[model samples]
Target: MIALKRLQILLPFVGIAVLLAVWSLTVWARIVDPVLLPSPVSTFRAMWIGMTSGKLGVDFLKTVERTIYSTAIAAIIAIPFGILLGSSEKVYRSVEFVIDFFRSTPASAMFPLFLVLFGVGDRTKISVAAFGAALVILFNVAYGVMNARKTRILAARVMGASRLRILWDVMLLESLPQTFVGLRNGVSLALVIVVVAEMFIGSTDGLGQSVFEAQQLFNMPDMYAAIFAAGALGYGLNLLFLTIERRFVHWSGK
Candidate 1:
């Protein structure tokens, strides 16, 4: 079992190494133009330079800040309302069309509307991200509540628990695992929306802007570096949520 566990840990690293090897080979063989796809060494060098110059740090921080703000806004608005909706079939049915409509709409398609409403400022970018993230979180949270075991709720009622008490003690606990899933997805969507906004919505500074500028200037290495930074940020955020979920939702599958 110990050896099996060690192999499990080593397998991912092996896969990554194989991917890198392929990437390096392609670069070496000039399968693509170096201008379009710089060698991994050049990309690493550019990343190092950006880090040393503090530019990457600033851009990374800006993107991360926007993601956090949007996610917080989404969670604050979605959770309570989602719970309320889930607890009442009438309320859920009444708003189902509205929820489904907005959820189905692509966030990018709403960019122009948000830009007009909030203007081409940070507010517009954050608002767009928050809007998208909120819908995803709301959907997950409501379903989580709705899917709570009937037996558990019946038990609570039989024990003479108030409706509110049952909601808080039984439904809420049952929903936490799915809520965390929503949170993870919501934060990812928030980051994606914010980055896209920064790239095309006239942001002065951000990882997206940095990438856009690098590409416009034909600086492939810097562009790749910025892209890598953005990917790392997303991975880090997801990992964080996964850790939180594991710790708090320990009984999720069981």
Candidate 2:
């Protein structure tokens, strides 16, 4: 298992290494202009300078903090509503129309309203991220609830379990994996959207702001570095989420 897992992890890195090598060769051959496509060395130098000067490090932390805070807030609010709606047929049916409507709305479209209502600030940025992320969680939680094993539920009822008891002991427990999946998706989306929202809203510092500044100054390498860092964060956090999910859901054991 350990060997297989190690191989699985290494495979992607190997592919990335090959791609980078090709990129380096292509740049060296002048197939891609340095200005159009920066060499890895140049990008790395820019990253190193940004980090050593504390620009990249600071913006990275700020972006991470905002994403974490907003995602957590969204999860806190979404879980309850999901539970309530999921536990009842009537509630689910009634709210499904509204939930579907909001969920279908693009998060970016809501940014203007958020800016007007909250003004350009951390609060508005975080709120937009939280609200956008919450919608995804809400739908997933509802999905988990609606799709829960009906046989298990029927058996519980036949065994004289009360609705509340069935919910706590069966419904919620059974739906945890799906719920976690929702939270994971929400966290990822929150990270992406929050950064975009922060770039224009009122953020003083963040990876998004770094990207914006880089564009304004025509610092392509710096912009690429920040973008690369964002990709790394997303990939890293996704792996972290899988680890946590595996720990909690032992049925998913290797």
Candidate maximizing TM-score: 1
For 1-254, candidate 1 gives per-residue lDDT tens digits of: 99898789787699789878999999999998877888889998999889678588789899999999999999999999999999987889899899999989989999999989999899999999999999999989998999999999999999999999999999999999999989999999999999999999998899989999888999899999999999999999999999999998999989
lDDT of each: 0.93, 0.86
- Give residue 161's lDDT in candidate 1 (0 to 100): 100
Any residue pairs clashing in model 1, and if so which?
none
Candidate 1 wrongly placed segments (more than 4 Å): 1-8
Which residue ranges in model 2 land beyond 4 Å of their true spot? 1-10, 252-254
Writing each residue's lDDT as its tens digit, candidate 2 over 1-254 gives 99898788677689789989998999899997677678888888888888778599899888888889889999999988998888886889988888889878878889999888988788887888899889889888877887779999999999999989999988898878888888899999899888898687767799999888988888788988888888888888788888998889766423
